[model samples]
Target chain A: MKSQDQVLLSVRNLVKNFELRANSGLRKTKRIVQAVSDVSFDVHVGQTLGLVGESGSGKTTVGRSVLQLIQPTSGEVIFEGQDLTKMSFEQLREVRRQMQIVFQDPFASLDPKMTVGSSIAEPLVVQGVQGNHHDKVAELLDLVGLASDHAKRFPHEFSGGQRQRVGIARALALDPKLIVLDEPVSALDVSIQAGVVNLFSDLQKRLGMSYIFIAHDLSVVRHIADQVAVMYLGKIVEIGDKDAVYRRPSHPYTKALLSAVPLPDPKVERSRSRIMLEGDVPSPVNPPTGCRFRTRCWKATDLCAAEEPQLEIRSSGQQSACHHPE
Target chain B: MSESVLQIRDLRVTFNTQLGELRAVRGVDVDVAPGEILGVVGESGSGKSVSFLAAMGLLPKSATISGSVKLDGVELIGASRKAVRSVRGKSLAMVFQDPLSALNPVHRVGDQIVEMIQSHQDMNTHDAEKKAVELLEIVGIPQPDERARQYPHEFSGGMRQRVVIAMAIANNPKVLIADEPTTALDVTVQAQILEVIQRIQQTFGTAVVLITHDLGVIARVADSVNVMYAGRNVESGSVQSIFDHPSHPYTRGLLSSLPHEGIERLQPIAGFPPNMLAPPPGCGFAPRCQLAIEACSAELPSLVPFGDLLSSCIRADDLRSGIRS
Candidate 1:
C-alpha cells in the first residue's frame, strides 16, 4: 500500500463538456455533450492509476483534462501540492516540464521528417536544458530498451513498438514526475505489446515515477495498475485496488464488462455464464439523467432511473457507483 | 465428423506488389462442418483473413489464388465471376468487422437487404421488405420495422453489426464467414453479438468461419480452432484439445503471451512475425519459437499427426507429452 504523504496527483470533481452544433431541417441548434462528469481520484507517487473504459466512455477525456490538454468545465487538479486548474499560462509552463504524456499511435505523435533523436531532444531544448542534448537523447533511447544508434533514424524507419519506445523516451526526457500514457499498448500487436509493457514497468522502477495509464483493455490495465478506476460515460463506476476490483466487481456494468472479456482458457470460457447486455451505449448529448448505464442494465429499477448513485465503498470493499449493486 | 459445408485445401494466395510478390497465404487448409464454428486466430499478416477472402472471391484481380475451395462440392477457386456471384448470397455470406464500411450509407438498411433478396431470387419489393424486417428482428435489433428505415449512420456500432448480420443471413447462407465481427464494438456489446451469432448458428445450422486475433472470442464460440503463424496453419484441433494440450511451440507461445487476470508477467514471443516476401525456407515460426531445434530451420515442417491434433513442428511429438526441452 502507498503512504498517504506522497500523493502525486489528486483529481477532484473533474468535468469536461463539449458543445456542438446540429443541423435539423435547415435549423442549426447547439448541443452540449458531457464527456466527463464529476470524476475524482488520487494517484500515489511511484505508482500507477489506471483509467479504463470503452469508446465514448470519456476515459481519454479524463486523461486529457488532467494534463490540461483541454480545459475542464469544472474541476481541481492538484499535482504535487499545486492546483494546476488555478495556475496561469506563465505558471503552467514551468509546471508542464514535470508533467508529460505518451500517446497511443507512435506514427502520428512523432514528426516524420525529424530524426528520432531530435524528437526526444526537442522537449529538453524547450525547457532550456543546459547539458548536451545528443547525450541525453542516447541515454533516453538506451533507457527505453532501444539501441543508442537508433537516434539518427526517422520515425518511419522504426517499427510500431520501437516508435512507441521513442515516444516513451521523449516523455521521460524532462525527468517528469508523472506521465499520462493514453492507450499506449492498445494499438500494438499481442507479441509486441508485452515488450513495451515490460519496458514501462522497468522505466518506472528505475525512475520512481508515477503514471496515469489510460486504456480500454482491462487485462493490460490489470498488469500495470496498482489502483484501478472504471469509467462509464464520464463517471467512475468503480474504483478499487487491482485485486479487489478484478476479483469481485460489484456493479452490474463492471461485472458485465469483466464477464464479456473472453479468457484464452477454453475450459473456463466455455463454462462461464456470460452476461449479455442489450443495446448500445446511449448518446452523450442527452445522457440518461440518473445512471448512464441503467438503460442497458438488467437490474434497472425506478430508483436507478430517478436518483443518481454515489461512488461509495460497499460490502465488497470496492467503491461502486450503483444503488442496486450485487 | 458431420458433412463439411465448406472445405479448403492447399490454399495459397500471393499478391504482386511494388516490393515483389507477397505470399499472403501459404498452404492453408480448413474444414467447416455444418452447424459448427471454426475459429481461425492469428496476429496481423498471418493470412487468416486473406485465405477466407480468397475463398470468397473477394480478392483483387492482381492477386493469384491457387487452392481448392469447395462449398458442398462446388469449386470456388476457378469458378467464373457469374458462377461465384450466384452462390455468394444464397449459399455463402460474410460479415465484416466495421459495418459502417460494409453498409451503404446512402441506402436504408431494409432496402439493402431487400436488394440482396431481389438480386438472388424472385420476390416483389413489398414481400422483400417484409422479409428484411423479419431478418432484423431475428438479429435482436429493437424496433425492427422502424430501424430498417434508417440509414447506416443512425444505428450504433453494435446495432450496425446486427444489421450486417441481418444482411448476411438474409438468404440463409450455408457458410457464414465473420472476420473480426465483434472487434469494433464494446466488450458488453461484443458479448451480445457473440450470442446473436451462436443463436444464428444453432437455428439455421449454418457453418461459421470466425476469424479474429482475440483467443477469448475463439474459445467462447469455436468448436474447432486453427492457430496460424506466418501464413501457415501451425496447429489445428478441437477447442478442448487445443486449449488443454497445445502441441505446437508457436501455439504455446501465443497462449502464454496472452494477458489473463491470473497471469503475473506475460511471456512475450521474442521476435516479430516473418516477412511474407522472403520467408525462411524452413518453418517460418522457428526464429521466434522457444522450443525450436536445429532441424526446425533446416526444413519446413509439414502438418503431421500429433496426438489428437495436427501440428507443423518436428517437436510436436515431444511436446504432446509432459516433456520440455
Candidate 2:
C-alpha cells in the first residue's frame, strides 16, 4: 500500500463545463457540454496514472483542469496541500511551474518559426532558472536522445519521434513534479511509439516525477502506468492498480475495450471472441439517462437507465462504477 | 496463385525535389491474388504509400517511375494518361488515409457517391441517388437515407470513413487499396471501419491491399503480410508464419516492440528508420538490427524462401537453426 505522504497530487469532484451559444438568434441560449463530471483521482510521486478513453470522453479536459490550464467549474485540485482551484491568477501561474503538459501533436505544439533549442529553453527562461541557457539546452537535447547539434534545426527537420523527444525535453526543462502526457505516442509510428514510451519510463525513473499519461491504447499504458483509470462519457467507470484493472476488468466498457485490442498473434486473434458493441457512442451533450454505456452495453438493463451508478470501492483499493460488474 | 489480380515487379519511383532525386520506392515487388487480403506493413517513409500510388498511376509528373505494374493483364506503367484514367475509378479504387480530405466538403456525401456511380455506369440521377443510399446502408451507416443528404462535416469520423468505403466500392472495383484507413480513428471505430471494409470485400469479391504500420490490425485482417523497410520488402509470408516465426531481424524486432496482451514490459527498437534519400550501403536496417554481422554491411540480402516464409536476410539459415553467431 502506498502511503498518503507519497501522493504527489489529489483531485476531488472535478467538474468542467463549457458554455456555447445554442443557436444563431436574438435569444442566445446557453448550452453546456459538461466536459468533465465529478472526476477524482490521486497520483503518487514517481508513479504514473494512465487516464484512457475515446474522443470526447473528457480525458483531455481532466488533464487540463488539474493543471488549471482551463478554469474548472467546481472541485478541488490539491497539489502538495495547496488547492489549485482556489488560487488566484498570479498564484496559479506560480503553481504552473511545478506542473507541465506535453501535448499530443508535437508539430502543432512546437512553434514552427522557432528553433528546437529555443523551444526547450523557453521554459527555463520563463521560470528564471539561472544558467547558461545554451548549455542547458544542449543537456536537455542529449537527455531525450537527440544529438546536441539537432538543437540548431527547426521542428520540420526532425521526424515525428524526434519532434516528440524535443517536446519531452521542453516539458522537462522546468523540472516539474508532475507532467501530463496527453497521447504522447499516439501520433508516432509503432516502432517510434515504443521508443517514446521507453523514454517516458526512463525519465520518470530518473527524475522521480509523476505523470498523468492520457492515451487510448491500453497496451502502451500497461507498460508504464502504476494505476489505470478507464473513462467513458466524462466519468471514470473503473480505476485500480494496473495489474488488477487489466487482468480482471469489472466494468463492461472496460471488458469491451480490452477485447477490442487486436493481438499481434494470428492464432490468439482468431481464438479470442470480440465483444462487438452494437451502436455508436451517443452524443456527449445529451448523454444517456443513467449509464452512458447503456446504449451499446450488452449487459445493460432497466436499472442501468433508471439511476447512474457511482464509483465505489469494490475491494480493498479497486473501484468500479457499474450496476452489474463482472 | 492462378492469375495474380495485381502484379508489381521491380517497381521503382523517384521524385525530383529541390534537395535531390529522392528514391521513394526501390525495386519493390508485390502481388495480390483475387479475393486475397494482402497486408503491407511498414513504418513511415518506408515507401508503402508510394508503391501503391505508382501502381494506381496517381503520382504527379514530378515522380519518375520504372518497372512493371500490371492489373488484370493491363500494364499500368508507361501507359498513356487516358489509358491509366480508364482503369482507375472503374476497375480499381483507393481509400485514402483521411476521408475528410479525400472527400469534397462542398458537396453532400450522397451526391459525391452518386457522381461516382453515374460516371462509371449508365445510370440516371434518380437511380444513382437510390444506389447511393443503398451503398450507405450496406456499410452499416445508421439511418442511411437521412445520412445521404448530410455533408461530410456532419458525419462523425467513423461515419465519414463509411462514406469513403461506399465511394470506393460504388463501381465494384476488382481491387481496393486502403491506405491506412483506420489511422485517424479510435480503436472501436477502427474495428467498425475494418468490419465494413471486410464486408464490402466479401460481398463484391474484390481483392484488398491494406497498408498500415499497426501490426495488430494486419494480424486481424491479413491473409498474407509483407514487411517493408527503407523502400524494400524485407519479409513476406502467411500471417500465421510471420507472427509465429519471423525470420528477418527487422520483422522480429517489430513484433517484439509491440506491447502484447500478457507481456508486462515492452521491448522497444533502439534506432530510428534509415533515411530513404541516402539509404545504407547494405541492409537498410543493419545499423539498428541486433543480429547484424559484418557481411550484412557488405551487401544487400536478397529475399529468399525460408520454410514457407520469405525473408531478406543473410542469416536466414542461421536464424532457422537457432544460431545467432
Candidate 3:
C-alpha cells in the first residue's frame, strides 16, 4: 500500500465473516461465510480509491466495514490517525461526522416521507451545530447542482439522478473528509451516470474530499479513480495506480475481468476477442484452499493449488497476488 | 442479410394509469433475422422492454396496444388468443431477467422443462423428460440428470438462468427475446450466460433480441442495434455504423456519456429522461440535447436514412462525423 503523510483512512488486515443456518428438513447446519479476508488499503486527502469486483468479491463488504456500517470480525480501521475499532460509541459517533456514505439505489436510499430539505438537514441537526437550517440546506442543494427549490420536494418527485444529487448533498452537509460511494451511479442511466460521476469529480476538487468508490463498471472506475484495487472472492487480487493497472495488468483475474467488459464502439469490439473465464465464482463459505481463482485460471499449475500467493510489489508498482502474473 | 424472421411495424402501446395516460411505447419498430442478434439499447423508461412485450402479446389489460407483429410472414398482433398462445412458446419464446421468479419454485427443474416441451409437442412424460435432460446438456449444465432433480432454490443464479434458457430453447423456436437476462447475475456469470446464448443461436439458428441497458453487453452479442429514447427509436443501424458514426443527437449523447478506457472525463448529457405521461410534442430528447435547434422543439424529427443507418435527427447531415471524446 502507498504510504502518505496525509493519510485520511487506513485499513489493515480487515476481515468480516457472516453466520448462517441452512435447514435440511430434519436438522440445521451452521456455516460461516468469509465475506472479506485480510483486505487492506490506504486513502489520502484529495484522492479516490476505486474498488472493482463482481458479486461475492467482498468489495461492498470492505466499503461497509471501513464506514463502520457493519462491524468487522477482525481488523483495524484508522481514521485521521485514530483507530475506529478501539473507539467507544460516543467517540465513534464524534468521528462519524467526518465520514459519510452514498448508497447505490437512489430510489430506496431516500426516505419517501421526508422532504429533501429535512433529509439534508438531519445531519446538521444531529451534529448540534447551530445555524440557519434552511440556509444551510439551500446552500447544500446548490452545491450538488440541484435547485434550492428542490429542497421542498420529496424523493419520489425527483428523477434517479436528482435523487442521487440529494444523497450527495446530504453526505456533503456534514463536511465529511471521506465518502464511501457504493455503486453511486449504477442505478442511473448511462447519460445520467456521467453527470453524477462528473459531480463527484468536481466535489473532490472543490471540497478536497477523499473517496472510496466501489463499482463493478471498470470503464467508469477508470475516470474517477486514482488508485485501483481488484478484489476476487474476499481478497485483493491486484492493486495499483489506475493507468498502470489498466494498461499493463499483471494479474490473470484482472485481465479476464477487463476483457469481459464490452466497449460501446462496434469497431473496437469486433477487433477484440474476449478472454472468458470458466465456471461461476466459488462459494465464499467453502472457497478453494490455495488460490481462490485457480478453478477458473487458464494458467493454473499444480503449485498454484498447493501454495497461496502473497501480495508482492511487481515491476510496474502493482501489488499483485498471483503466482503466475501476466 | 437473410430475411427477417420476426418483424415489428409501427408498434404503439399506451397504459391507462391513474397519473394520466402513459404512452410507454410510441410507434416503435424492430426486426430480428434468422441466426442474428438484435440489440435494443435504452434507459429505464426508453420503452425497449414495452415494445417487445407488445410484440409478444403479453401486456396487461390496462395497456392498449396496436401494431403489426409478423413472425415469418404470419400475423401475431391481432391474432386470436388461442392462435397467439399456440405460436408463443412453439414458434417464439422469451427469456426474462429473473429466472427465479419466472420458473416454478416447487417443481423440479427437469419437470418444468418437460412441461415446456410437452405443451408444444404433445409428448408423453418419458420422452419430454428425455428431451428436458438433453436441453439441459445443451445449455452447458454439467450432470444434467442429477441437476434436473434439484429445485430452483438449490441452483446458483447463473445455473438457474441456464435452466431458464434451456426451457426457452426447448421447442427450438425461431426467435428468442431475452430481456436483460444477465443484469441480475455477476459479471463472470454474465459472461457464461452470454456464452450459452451465443451457443444457442449457433446451434439452433434462433434469432435473438437482446434487450439490455449495458452497451458492453450489446456490443458483445448484437449484430445490429436500435437506440431508443423516450419510448421511440431514435436510431437504427448495424453495430458498426451505430458505433463508428452515430448520426442522432441522442445516440451520440449515449456513446459520449459511456465511460471508456481512454476517457479522461465524462461528457454526460444534461437533464433527465422525459416523463412518458406527457411526452414532449416535439423531439422527445430536445430538452436535454445539446444539438437541439429551434426546429427540434417545433416538430418531431422523422427518420432519415444515411449510409447504412437511419437517424431521427434533423441535424443528422450537419453532424455527420459523429461525437467522440
Model 2 regions more than 4 Å off: A1-5, A22-27, A112-115, A132-135, A147-157, A315-317, B261-265, B323-325
Lowest lDDT sum, 10 consecutive residues, model 1 chain B, at: B316-325
User: How would you encode candidate 3's per-residue C-alpha lDDT over B1-325 as one tens digit per residue?
Assistant: 6778999888899999999999998887777889999999999999999898888889999999998999999999889999999988888999999999989999999999998988889789998989999999999999999999999998989999999999999999999999999999888789889999999998888999999999888887899999999888999998887888888888888888988766668988888888999999888999998778889989766677877899888888778854433
At residue B250, candidate 2 shows an lDDT of: 85
Better of 2 and 3 by lDDT: 3
Classify candidate 1 by CAPRI docking class.
medium
How accurate is chain B of model 2, given as a TM-score from 0 to 1? Answer: 0.96
Residue B75 of model 1, lDDT score: 97
For residue A147, give model 2's deviation from the true position in Å: 4.5
Q: List candidate 1 segments past 4 Å from native.
A: A1-5, B321-325
Fnat of model 2, as a fraction: 0.59
User: TM-score for model 3?
Assistant: 0.97
Q: What is the lDDT of candidate 2?
A: 0.89
Kindly report which residue stretches of model 3 are placed more than 4 angstroms away from their true locations once superposed: A1-5, A23-28, B321-325
Docking class of 2: medium
**Could you tell me how far off, in angstroms, the CA of residue A95 lies in candidate 2 after the best superposition?**
2.3
Instruction: Looking only at chain A, give the TM-score of model 2 against the true structure.
Output: 0.96
Task: Give the distance in Å from residue B110's predicted Cα in candidate 2 to where it truly belongs.
Answer: 2.4
